[model samples]
Target: MSEVPAYLREGYITPDELFRKIPKPSEERLRARPVAVPECPQEIPCAPCREICPTNAISMPTPNDLPVVDYEKCIGCSLCVQICPGLAFFMVHYVGDKARITMPHELLPLPERGEEVVLLNRIGEPVGKGKVLTVVPREKTKGDTPIIIVEVPIELAWDVRAIKVVRE
Candidate 1:
């Protein structure tokens, strides 16, 4: 394949993009609860994340533009994460000691709540272990992709995006 244009490269948004967009919530704000981090970097025309946001946290006037999010308004509900066809949204919650990170999970033999699993990084490299907090199916994902919430160390939470479960 030919070299991907810089603009097209943006389509492959990653956790790093989400990290950059994450607003620094004050200790007081953090106390209030969670917020969302959108990693959608594509210049393509897509706005499901914006339209599906119940709180109007994500907004996009034109399909060609990237969605804008109101950090304070975002509830970290992970609805955008599940509704995004590009699988570009991630909900992050920094709590007392661990971070509640939710990402889209489409694999079969889904992980169960309270189950232990091997955590993987952005590139799918095993990092550590985490406990499944919840497994949201398509029934509740706006008829789109399902989602999973995991509890891990705040440090690893930002890097870990995928998990491994022994199906055998």
Candidate 2:
């Protein structure tokens, strides 16, 4: 097994973990239902998600308000996930008859490339199985979070939004 990175071993809290604790936007407030996007609650000054959006899909317009994503134009490339300082971005793709979710994972002893893992939904519920498709470890990403791409059944794609490695 690979050694866990010092950050993970030192008990540091990652942005993804922190963001997951925030309540998701209520369905009534959303114009587009079913598509999950980060609705930042805090008055943080970070706007990487807005600046990094290739399609200008995410808009901050101002610094203090939450960033808004235009899902219609958003490509779900996960560029926001790679740039957000808060690690608050995630991508869900219901394509080719299967649902695929991409999130920021910074744990050490990272899952082996192509390993199978159990997928968890936004509510942290185990909904189905998924296979690791990519592990992005880049310098710009603070190298703390690894971008995990998990593939699940098409029917459960949207429902299975997060993943937890199945420990032996």
Candidate 3:
């Protein structure tokens, strides 16, 4: 068997490797729950999530260390989602039939509820189509960062992060 490649097309680790490296707390429980998942794999010196967390759920041992979520302490407030400068913070809610993914929306013409959009992966590949379940504008955000909630298939929850909303 060959070892995992040093880098993929996106110049980062593979999805399987990333999942193995990152700790998921939501899976430990059975009930539907919301959890914060940071896709930051680099050792960059940033700590906005730790500084802005009202519950002190995110821990940063050093400046360069990426944010680690203490799922027990996280209240699913999505403050980190808005405060994350790199737009790497996302919250996922695993519901009965769908998964709600909340992501930072800095682009113009924000998405709205009931709008259909193309779901894309980390590498800009269209995974599937999803429906916009909710949209939080800048004014309603904690850090003035607009966020949109899209409902996708339960299985695509982890694979789908961002959406391509059609604009006229």
Candidate 4:
């Protein structure tokens, strides 16, 4: 952890900074329901996530501060995910042995439900395979961004942020 992460060096919020901005969720909360994880660690003048949260879970003290989420108030809704301009918000729900990640997808061709897709990390590098659980169409999102829900190994819940559809 000595070397600075790309997010930090690139002027984005670091993992350590994000961790301190929001309270840590308990295992029970993480395992029981979906929580919105804001990967937007930058101090940009953004507040859509805070404004759209129905449960008032996301908050920003000032215009340029990073958004913070109160996991206890988050109702697992993907409103923030769909409305994010930076596409940094993700909904994570942990099941028995797997984790369901709901992420924004703006690709040309979307994957189908039950289709196998390549899991990707923050930098778009292929990490593993995941199964598509659901695909929320663009018409359903506030910002016209479609959302894809994929199921992957529990260990990948934190690492996997995006997906790559392997077409023939």
Candidate 5:
């Protein structure tokens, strides 16, 4: 079996615990529509996103702080997925009438391109059906990264952040 990281094995690390420790936006601000390009919340040691940016849109002056991404210049190449150890990077394209989102999908029985799948929201709730546009397997990716790009309705773009293929 793969060994668990020291932090996780020691019960000293958890996604929720880390999020809770970070400052959050106000309730009123949370209700407003999020910007196309979201800001990073913590000063964590991560620079892969910056280095992976083909357009040089992301900048990280320090290793511990979150990198800044310039959305206007970003090309949505999904290169960050290959570099981020936390798998925290994603690409959102809202200009094609429909919204195209590319995210890192690490799971078994990977879906094929053009397959119809159920899109899920940030809370892991089913929202709608989305068509897979591309499935970049680990072999094609820089490492063990599998990039899944899906296209969904423009209105549901922001709501649908992930996908689960329906079993036949």
Candidate 6:
């Protein structure tokens, strides 16, 4: 029998599994500008990410279909990031040697812009350190889910999905 998907087995999609299930943004796309990267691997009934996209970049043939992002049409706006009910959408933008990752932030004591944070991967494992670049307040988002942008090494961009704010 075919093996169970890693997302089902491990409760989170591993990088390898994610790349296998969805097309990774082309290198040319990554260097162009910020783009929405949906990590939703499950075929469950969900479509807010696609519905709320202002650029019509995210598309799903049906409610249960996995999201497909048209990188070229994406404007890199964080609307998808803020609207996704599962918090599966992210924005990746490379600037020189560093990359900015914009993701939904629901944790308490939100990190301020320029604050240092511990970057975490899909399974909540610490991957590296990064700095908060921007925090879109909840008042601006559709569901009141705040969004934050953290800058990390370009190499860690794809792996850094969440952050842990260390309070002094």
**Using TM-score as the measure, which candidate wins?**
6
| Order of the predicted models by TM-score, top scorer first | 6, 4, 3, 1, 5, 2
RMSD in Å for model 6? 1.2
The lDDT values for all models are 0.75, 0.64, 0.80, 0.86, 0.65, 0.88
User: Which residue pairs come into collision in candidate 3?
Assistant: none
Model 6, range 21-128, lDDT digits (tens) per residue?
A: 788888778889988888899999988888888888888999999998988999987788888889888889888999999999898888999999999987788988
Candidate 3 per-residue lDDT over residues 17-130, each given as its tens digit: 566757875554313467887777778988888898899889889979867888878888888998888888898887787888889877777887899999988667899999
Q: Give the clash count for each candidate.
A: 0, 1, 0, 1, 0, 0
What tens-digit string does per-residue lDDT give for candidate 2 at 1-168? Answer: 997654346444343543463433333322232233663555677787777678887777687767777666666667778766665676665556665667777666677679998777655778777888888876646335677777788666436646778787
Q: Per-prediction TM-score, please?
A: 0.83, 0.65, 0.86, 0.90, 0.71, 0.95
Residue 128 CA error for candidate 1 (Å)?
0.7
Off by over 4 Å in 1: 1-31
The top-ranked prediction according to lDDT is 6
Candidate 1: deviation at residue 30, Å? 4.5
lDDT, candidate 1, residue 127? 88
Candidate 2, backbone clash total: 1
Query: Model 4: residues >4 Å from true position, as ranges?
Result: 1-6, 10-21
lDDT of 5: 0.65
Error of 2 at 162 (Å): 3.0
Error of 5 at 148 (Å): 1.1
lDDT of 6 at 111: 91
In model 1, residue pairs whose N, Cα or C atoms come closer than 3 Å (at least 3 residues apart or on different chains), thus clashing, are none
Q: What does the lDDT read for residue 99 in candidate 3?
A: 85
